[model samples]
Structure formats: C-alpha cells, structure tokens
Target: MAEPFWLVRPRHDGGSDYVRFLPSQEAVEVREGSHLPPQMPLLKRRQWLPLKEAEDCRRHLQQEGGFRSSEPLF
Candidate 1:
C-alpha cells in the first residue's frame, strides 16, 4: 500500500494558527483547533512541500483537486 497524500490548508480560529489536511484531495469538513488525533503523523514546516508540488502529487494519485477559497471566510 502507498502512503496517503494530504493537501494542507492554513487556518486561524480567533487565536492561533492551525492546519487542516484533506487526505487524498477529498472534500471533507475540517476540524478546527489543535485537537487532531495524536496517532496522525504531522509534517514539520521545513518538511512541507509547495502547493504546486502538492498539486502534482494529487495528479499522480489520481485524486480530484478540491475547491480553494481565496478570500478569508471570517
């Protein structure tokens, strides 16, 4: 089996910055804050790839590119 690729989006919830990762480019509801499961592996800022690179990964994985919000939702 292959390791899953995730599209990470940076978000802020009134106080701190948190990231939401959409696994395999799926359009799922993102959970807010720093309450992610401890079992989930996290990538350091230096280990994170660029958006274009992520897009390429999505193509290689044959996953759909989900919608991207340009403007702030707040």
Candidate 2:
C-alpha cells in the first residue's frame, strides 16, 4: 500500500484544500475547498511534478503551509 496518504491545508475561514500524491501519474492532485451542504461540487487542480518536487510540497504543506497531514477527515 502507498504510505503517507494525504495532506490537507485548512483555512481560518473554514475552507480547506486536500492534496494527494499520484506517483503513477507523476503529479499531485489538489482538491480545492470542501463539499459543504452537498450542493457545491468540489474543484480539483492537478500539477505535473517530479517525485522530489511532490515530496517537497508534502513537506512544505505539513511544516510551513499549516496543513494537517494524513489525518482522518471525520
């Protein structure tokens, strides 16, 4: 199984960005904001990056970007 599943960047205003490392795809997938009230569709952004760059993003998100890492969304 893949390790260190996801990284989540949350905002003070109650919105969040969810990120996933897709090694096979050689990119990162970012889910912008939450799906609140079950009405608004979640927006997705993909970045084509190298493995090292993706890992760097994970590090930045966890340490400097104020993101919650690999935590349950419940």
Candidate 3:
C-alpha cells in the first residue's frame, strides 16, 4: 500500500474540483479534463501540503466527497 495524498483537478470554467486520494506524488499530473489547455506546459503551478494536512484532505474526500484514487494506465 502507498501513502494517501489528495489529487486536485481544476475545472475548465474556474476554481477546482477535488479529484481523489492518490498513492504517490508520481501519480500526480494534469490531464485532459484539467484546467490547463492541451498545449500548455505542465507543472506551471504547484502547491505543497504538509503530510498531516494531505492525509486529512485525502480522508475527507474519501468519506465526505466519495472520491477515489484513479489508477494510472501505464
């Protein structure tokens, strides 16, 4: 098992939609549905959260928001 982490997906309109809990940092990425344009460069924005805060968010999203971590295709 991997440590829990929150995955944030920004909406195309504005703000963000809290995605799900992820297993690792390597799994984080801005995909097609994210706020960024398809041709936009990646990692233009980054937010670092403390371990405790991240875990808390992960649990909240799971219990309250009914979000689940998405498995990478590769």
Clashes of each: 0, 0, 0
Candidate 2 overall lDDT versus native: 0.59
- Write down the RMSD of all candidates, one decimal each: 12.4, 3.5, 6.7
TM-score of predicted structure 3: 0.40
lDDT tens readout by residue for model 3, 1-74: 25433445445565344443334554432222233334433334344455566567567766776555654312
Please identify model 2 stretches exceeding 4 Å from their true place: 1-4, 12-15, 25-33, 37-41, 71-74
Task: Specify the poorest-scoring 10-residue window by lDDT in model 2.
Answer: 29-38
Top-TM-score structure, candidate number: 2
Q: Report the error of model 1 at residue 27, Å.
A: 18
Tens-digit lDDT string for candidate 1 (1-74) = 12333333333532222333343333322322322343343334333345556445445434443323223222
TM-score of each: 0.24, 0.60, 0.40
Residue range 1-74, candidate 2, lDDT tens digits: 13435677665656556766656554554433453333463656666566677777777878887777666343
**Deviation in angstroms for 5 in model 1?**
9.3
What lDDT score belongs to each candidate, Candidate 1 first? 0.35, 0.59, 0.45
Ranking by lDDT: 2, 3, 1
Global Cα lDDT for candidate 3: 0.45
